[model samples]
Target: MFKILDKQELAESIIEYTIEARDIARHHHAGQFCIIRVHSHCERIPLSIAETNSQAGTITLVVQIAGHSTQELAQLEAGDSILDVVGPLGQPTKIGSPRRGIFVGGGVGVPAGSSMVRQMKQAGAQVLAIIGFRSKDLIIYEEKMRAVADELVVTTDDGSYGYHGLVTEPLQERLAAGEKYDVVITVGPVVMMRAVAEVTRPYGTHTIASLNPIMVDGTGMCGACRVTVGGETKFACVDGPEFDAHQVDFAELAQRLEIYRDEELRAHEAGPHECRLEQALKELG
Candidate 1:
C-alpha cells in the first residue's frame, strides 16, 4: 500500500495528491504517467506525474474527479493507503535542446504540461508557456508554470481572467507576428490539441501533443491505448502519451476515447461502492 502523504483541492473536483512512492518518484521524468488503483477491486486509471520529490519519497498527481474510480480516490485523505501505484510508465519526453520552444495547455492539462516546461528550460531553451481555462476559478499551476517558463500567457474562454480569448489566439498571434519556435508542445483536450496543431501547421512548426486515450493497463500488452500517427499504429501506454501533433489522426483518436462513455456515465451515476447496507450490518455486528 502506498500512503497518501498529503491532499489538497486545487479546484472544484480537482485534487493534487502527494503519494509515497519512492522509486517511482526517483526515476520518473517529464512526460511520464502512473496507473493507480484506489482499492483492489477498483479499476485502474492513468494520471500524469505533475511533480516529484525524490528525497521525500513522494510523487504528486493531479486528479480530476471524472468517474467512479476517481471519486473513490477523492474520498481518501492524508494517511490513507492506496492499493496499487505503478509507474514511471510511458516514454519520457525527448527535449532535444531546442533554442526556443512553446508549451501550451488547457484546463487540467496545464499542470501536466508544466512538467515539460521545467525540463525545456533546464535544457537551455527559451520556453514560452500558454495556458487556458474555461474561467478563472479553473486555473491551476499558474505560478508553477510561470516560474519555469521564460514568459507565460494565461487565457480564459469567458474573459473571467487573463487574456479574454482561447489559448490558440495568443499562439496564432505569436506565429503570425513571425515568431518561430524550435518546437511546440501542447497537452489538452483532443479538440484543443487539434486546434494547436492547425495553428502551427501553416507556420510549419514542429509540434508535439500529449494524448489521452482509454488505457486499461499502463503496459503495451493491453493494446487499449493504440493511436494512429503518420498513418501508423502506436500505443499511448508504452510508445507514448506524446506524439507529433501534425501527424496524429485526431478524429480517430477522439472517437476512440468515447468508446466507454456509456459505461463511464453509468459508473458515475452509480456512485462509490461503499455498500452502506453492508456497513450498517457490520456496525450492528
Candidate 2:
C-alpha cells in the first residue's frame, strides 16, 4: 500500500496528495502519470505526477473531484494508504534542446504540466507558461509554475482575474508579435488545446498536446486509451499521451471523451460510492 504522506486542497474540488511511492518517485519523469486505486473494488483513475522528491520517496498527485473515482480519492486523508499506486507510466516529454518554449495549461492542467515547464527551464531554455481557468476562484499552482518559467501569464474566461481571456489569446498575440519559440506544449481541455494548435499552425510552431482519454489498465494491454494521431491509431498509455498537435484528430477525441457522460451523470446522482472497507467499518461502528 502506498501511504498518503500529505494532502492539500488546491482549489474548489481540487486536491493534491503527496504519496509515498518510492520506486515511482525515483523513476518518474515529466509527462508521466500514475493510476491510483483509492481502495479495493474502487475503479482506478489516472493522474499526472505534478512533482516528485526522489530523496523523500514521494510523488505529488493533483486530482480534480470530477466523478465517482476521483471523489473517492478525495475522501482519503494524510496517513491513509492507497490500495494501489501504479506508475511512472507513459513516455516522458521530449525536450530536445529547444532555445525557447511555451507551455500552455488550463484548470487542473496547470499543475499537470508544472514539472515539464520546470524541466524545460532547467535545460537552459527560456520558458513562457500560459495558464487559464474558468474564473479566479478556480485558479491553482500559479506560484509553482511562475517559479520555473521565465514568464508566466494567467488567464480567466470570465475576466475575473489576470489576462481576462482564453489562454489562446495570449499565445496568438505572442506569435503574432514576432515572438518565436522552438516548441509549444499544451495540456488542458480538448477544445482549448485544439484552439492553441490552430493558433500556432500558421506560424509552423512545433506544438505537442497531452491527451486524456478513458484509460483502464494503463499498460497498453487494454486498448481503451487509443487515439488517432495523423490518421494512425496510437494508445495514449504506451505510444504517447503527448503527440504532435497539428496532426491530432481533435474532433474524434472530443467525441470519444463523451462516451461515458451519461453513465457518469447517473453515477454522480447515485452519490459517492464507498469501498467495502468503508462500509464494513461503518457497520461495525
Candidate 3:
C-alpha cells in the first residue's frame, strides 16, 4: 500500500497528489507514469509522474477528475493508503542539449510537462515553457514551471489571464518571429497536440508529444495502449508515453478514445456509480 502524503484540490477538477512509494520514487523519471488502483478490485489507471522526491519517498501525481477512477482518486485524502501503486513505467523522454527548448502543455498536462522542463534545464538546456488552461483559476504549476524555465508563457481559453489565447497562438508567433528552438515538446489532448504539430510542421522543428491513448492494465500484457507510430504499432505503457508528434496518427487516436465511451456512459447510467450530476439535479429540484 502506498500512503497518500498530501492531497490538495488545485483547481476545478484538477488536483495535486503526493504519495509515498519508496521503490518507484527512488527511480522515477519524467515521461513515466504509475498505475493507480483505488482498491483491490478496481481497474488500474495510469497517471503521469509530475515529480518525485526519492529522499522523501514521495511521488507526485497531477490529475483531472475525468472519469470513474479519477473521481475515486479525488476522494482519497492524506494518510490514506492506496491499494497499489506500481511504476516508473514507460520509456523515459530523451532530449538533446540545445540552445533553447520549448515545452507546451495544456490543462492537466502542464504539470507533467513542467517535470520535463525542470530536468531539461538541469541538463544545460535553456527551457521555455508554455502552459495553458481554460482560465486563470484553472492554471497550475506556474511557480514550479517558472522555477526552472528561463522563460514561461501562460495562456488561457477564456482570456482570464496571461496571453489570453491558446498556447499554440503564442507558439506560432514566437516561431514565426524567429525565436528558434532545437526541439518542441507538447503534452495535452489529442486536438491540442495535433494543432501544435501543424504549427511546427512547416518550421521542421522536431516535436515530441506525450500520448495517453486508452490504457487498461498499463502493461504490455493488455495491448490496449498500442498506437501506430512511424507505421509501426507500439505500446504506450512500455515502448513510450512520448512520441514524435509528427508521426502520430491523431485521427485514429481521437476515434479510438471514444470507442469505449458508450459502455462508460452505460455504466454511469446503469446506477451503482456515485455521480455529481445526480446530486446536482436533485439539489436543483
Candidate 4:
C-alpha cells in the first residue's frame, strides 16, 4: 500500500497528494507517469508524476477530479493508503542540450510541466514556461514553475490573472517577435496542444507534446493507450506519454478519448460503490 503522506486542495476540484513511494520517487524522471488504483476493485487511472523527493521517499500527483476514480482519490486524506501505485512509466522527456526552450502547460498540465522545466534549467537551457488556466481560481504551481523557468508567463482565458488570453498567445507573440528557441514542449488539453504545434511548426522549432489518452494496465500489454505518431501505432504507456507533436494525429486521439463518455457518466452517476453493488445484484439475479 502506498501511504498518502499529505494532501492539499490546490484549486477547485483539483487536489495534490504526496505519496510514500520510495522506489518510484528515487527512479522517476521528468515526464513519466504512474497508474494508480484507488482500491482493489476500482479502475486504474494514469496520473503524471508532478514532483518527487528522493530523500523524502515520496512522489506528488496532482489530480483534477474529472471522473469517478479521481473523485474517490480526492476524498482520500493523509495517512490513507492507496491500494496500488505502479509506475515511473513512460519515457522521460528528452531534454538534450538545447540553448533555449519553451514549455507550455494548461490547467493540470502545469504540474506535469514543472519537472520538465526544472530538468531543462539544470541542463543549462534557458527555459521559458507558459501556463494557462480557465481563471485565477484554476491556476496552480505558479511559484514552483517560476522557480525553475528563466521566464514564466501565466495566462487565463477570462483575464482573471496574468495575461488575458490562452497560453498560445504569449508563445506566438514571442515567436513572432523573432525570439528563437531550440525546442518547444506542450502538455495540456488536446486542442491546446494542437494549437501550440501549429504555432511552432512554421517556425521550424522542434515540438514535443505529452498525450493523455484512455489508458489501462499502464503497460504495453493492454494497447488501450495506442496512438498514431507519424502514421505508426505507438502505445502511450510504453512508447510515450510524450511524442513529436508535429506528427501526432490529434483528431483520431480526441475521438478515441470520447469512446466511453456515456459509460463513464453512467458509472459516475451510479457512484463508485453503488456501481459495484449494481453489478453484484445483477450477477445474483
User: 105-189, model 2: which lDDT tens digit per residue?
Assistant: 9888888788999888878899999999999999999999888899999999999999989999999999999999999999988
Badly placed stretches (over 4 Å) of model 4 are 274-285
lDDT per residue for candidate 3 within 173-243, as digits (tens), equals: 99999988888989988899999999999999999999988666677876778888988898998989999
- Clashing pairs for model 2 are none
Q: Residue 208 in candidate 1 has what lDDT?
A: 93
Between prediction 2 and prediction 4, which has the larger lDDT?
4
Question: lDDT of each model, Cα atoms only?
Answer: 0.89, 0.88, 0.84, 0.90
lDDT of 4 at 118: 85
**Candidate 3 Cα outliers beyond 4 Å, as residue runs:** 271-285
Q: Of models 1 and 2, which has the larger lDDT?
A: 1
**What is the Cα-based lDDT of residue 223 in candidate 4?**
72
Model 2 scores a C-alpha lDDT of 0.88
- RMSD of candidate 1 to the true fold? 6.0
Using all chains and alpha carbons, the TM-scores for the candidates as numbered come to: 0.94, 0.94, 0.93, 0.95
Q: Could you give me the TM-score of model 1 versus the true structure?
A: 0.94
Where does the lowest 10-residue lDDT sum fall in candidate 3? 275-284
After superposition on all CA atoms, how large is the RMSD of candidate 4?
A: 3.5
Off by over 4 Å in 1: 270-285
Q: Cα deviation in Å at residue 48, candidate 3?
A: 0.5
The residue pairs found clashing in candidate 3 are none
